[model samples]
Target: MSDVSARDAARDKARDRDGAMSMAGMSSERIESDENVWTRRLVTFLRVMAVISIMKGLYHWAQVTGFIGSEEEAFENQSMAWQTATVYFAVIELVAAVGLWLATPWGAVVWLTTVVSMAVIELMFPGIYGGSLTVVALEAVMLGAYLALAWMAARERPP
Candidate 1:
């Protein structure tokens, strides 16, 4: 073979070898890290958070729709603003949950924003949204877990 043809053949072989271990059905920027424990843990954490987010969304939706309890029970005689906020939270949270489940960058960002926003709303509105110390504590814990997993995944280069 000519020199140029031989070099092209060698390069193709190298690419094929590298591609063998690459993940399929994911973005090109994603990298498989099966050997990395941190990646595995991070994925698990994200999935767990996704489930929680979905459940939270559903709960809020039930409240807003008056399926779970009376309107008074859900809103606790809160103003229209608080009631509207509840509906908004339900929709945004459900969307964010799906994004997080897909392991997309936007999902993480949305989930983080949703959690923080909920915490703030609860704190500011207090009894209007059935805010409680327990809810705040749980949010803090989940937020910490998400941040730690994100940092680990970034460091490990998860697939």
Candidate 2:
């Protein structure tokens, strides 16, 4: 290829990389600028995560203090492993919830951290958790949401 053609090709590649986030897909400039929609979404994700965390914290507190019960009335079930898992999961959820609510860097950190943590845990101990699939999918979506907002906010450089 000609030198001029090679230069054009390189420039085109760079543009393509930038275009992935060029924001050209945004239909309305006002919405894009205000982030009213985005903020609502971010807040929703954060709140859900936060509430889950708070509930989880409370759940763990109950288990650690020997307060959790089995109203199922089936097989006298409940074990140390279950208690430990309850607390562990609760702690992670609590951190994620708080971080998200505050919208601090910690929240973003928690999002990424817990997303990977839960995914790894699910793979590591599939049978241990009854609702791992639901939890993983939820966290994965939240993680994506947080990351997208973070990237947009950073790239937009709003003043």
Deviation from truth (RMSD, Å), model 1 = 7.5
TM-score of 1: 0.70
* lDDT values, one for every candidate: 0.81, 0.68
Give lDDT tens digits, candidate 1, residues 1-159. Answer: 699999999999989877875545444776655667777787788888889889989988888777887656766565787788888889988998898888888998898888888788788877566778788788999999878877876787635
Best by lDDT: 1
Q: How close is every model to the real structure, measured as TM-score?
A: 0.70, 0.57
Model 1's lDDT to the true fold?
0.81
**Candidate 2, residues 112-157: lDDT per residue as tens digits?**
7767877766767775555477878876876787779656655544
